[model samples]
Target: MAGDLYPDHGVTGTENRQYNREQRAGKHEADAALYKSHQCEQTPHPGSWRRHDQRTQGPLVAGYGIYTQGQEILLTFSFCSSLVSGYVITYFPLRGRSETIRLILSDQGAKWTEEEVQFTDWFTANCEHKKQAVFGQLPKFKDGDFVLYQSNSILRYLGRKYGIAGGSNQESALIDMVNDGVEDLRMKLVRVLFYEPEKGTEKYEADLPDQFSAFERILSQNSNGTRFVVGDQISYADYNLLDILHVHLALFPACLASFPLLTAFSDRISSRPKLMEYLKSEARKNRPIVPKK
Candidate 1:
């Protein structure tokens, strides 16, 4: 999977660390301000879950009540505003597996920053950052002090954190099913792109129709394809599926001609306000689906 997006390249571990340190340094001040304003220390809530400020490595809790003998407990609580400070994605410059995660953040208008990993940095034998990856892969994610690897896990984590997974257990399972299906197809695409770019492209295109029909069928089950794939509200699955559709659309402009429902689904998702803006931004531009060979 790492080879799918990250091909062999070379660089010094020290250089990669220096680059990340600089990136983190630039955002430290602004992130600190956001933490101060939104963290639990400033805004407490009833039965608030504990959160940590990664910058300070301090605990932030709320909703505890003071008890007095033979008196009612005075619970101090209030509605807490959005306390999620920011997110960081460390990946190579290509869209690859990380694009879906980016789409979710953009659609939600969440604060986030990217720590671009040069190809050389990922493949470097002595890369300190590489050693930190539990799975020895790219696209590691960070939310405050918590760190996670694997693109699918990161997507689900964001989905749950942002309440986009679904409303019910059944719906959430359906959403996961959709995302897993998308991942299966994505792996096939990766094979063609990285393993056999010469002759594999033609064969993959030939089978593309049958592959896409599965998603088209999924959409047909919901509002004749007008609604989201799993539930009424868009889930992480939508983002993941839409990203793959975009990539296929680029590969075969006429790919979705036979699947009107999918075409509409892609159109509708791309038209979302924040997502639309992100799709056109410089940050999204020039980043190829895969890194250049």
Candidate 2:
């Protein structure tokens, strides 16, 4: 563009290319320096490494992206200010995947902490704390520097390590079955809650009976469904299922009564000493059951 506008400027094509390249380089370098000094910036997309001048002091404020020939190449970067725990899950401050994992940590009394992220600053930070995430999704588990993705996979790893998965292969299989069911419901509910809030409520209301019925039957099969979802003790399956139930009941208060076993199961799990205390804590209290208007 510079060369086209100034035909008499005596700049050759090769010189023009080099000149433009240097101009872009200078822009980025200046932007970087300005960001480091001021702590943040508002930049357009379709570019590389937009810096995150975070107000908070922590590890790797975030990562940015690169756009080349109409393709986006995501690059992750970090500016570590302090050492975070070996066990950390970075996600939006919501009780979604992270919450289930939090339940695991709370129940097991594990040494863990959180890395809550902000969406507005996500891409600018070059994916920041979520760089190691498998698909750039949230609730990524970082053990020291080793990162793990997929919420359920992290839960399973912890479950296996902590002995909460189960004692036998058969038991693990059962837990998987329950966990799969939870995921199916979770996906649907997520679509409803986030994307289709207006129409989803009525549609989900119609589907509730059948959905709750399936879990009711599962609970009914296990020794009259008087206890946990599987086996005689608490398993990793309970946390996911319990979270699903929590959201379902919050959205549809009367939906669980038809499934007495599930209702009882929800109450029982929510009453567990550690979990009950968690329910009463500021974390759970502060987090809204559904997205706010």
lDDT of each: 0.74, 0.69
- The alpha-carbon deviation from the true structure for residue 82 of candidate 1, after best TM-score superposition, in angstroms, is 7.9
lDDT per residue (tens digit) for residues 154-253 in model 1: 9888887667889999999999999999999999999898897877688898899999999999999988799999878888999999999999998889
lDDT of 2 by residue, 61-119 (tens): 34343343343222224332332325887887678888888787676554467777776
Model 2 worst lDDT run, 10 consecutive residues: 51-60
Model 1: lowest-lDDT 10 consecutive positions: 51-60
Model 1: lDDT of residue 33: 49
Q: Residue 106 deviation, candidate 1, in Å?
A: 0.5
Q: Positional deviation of 31 in candidate 1, in angstroms? A: 17
Which residue pairs does candidate 1 place in steric collision?
A: none
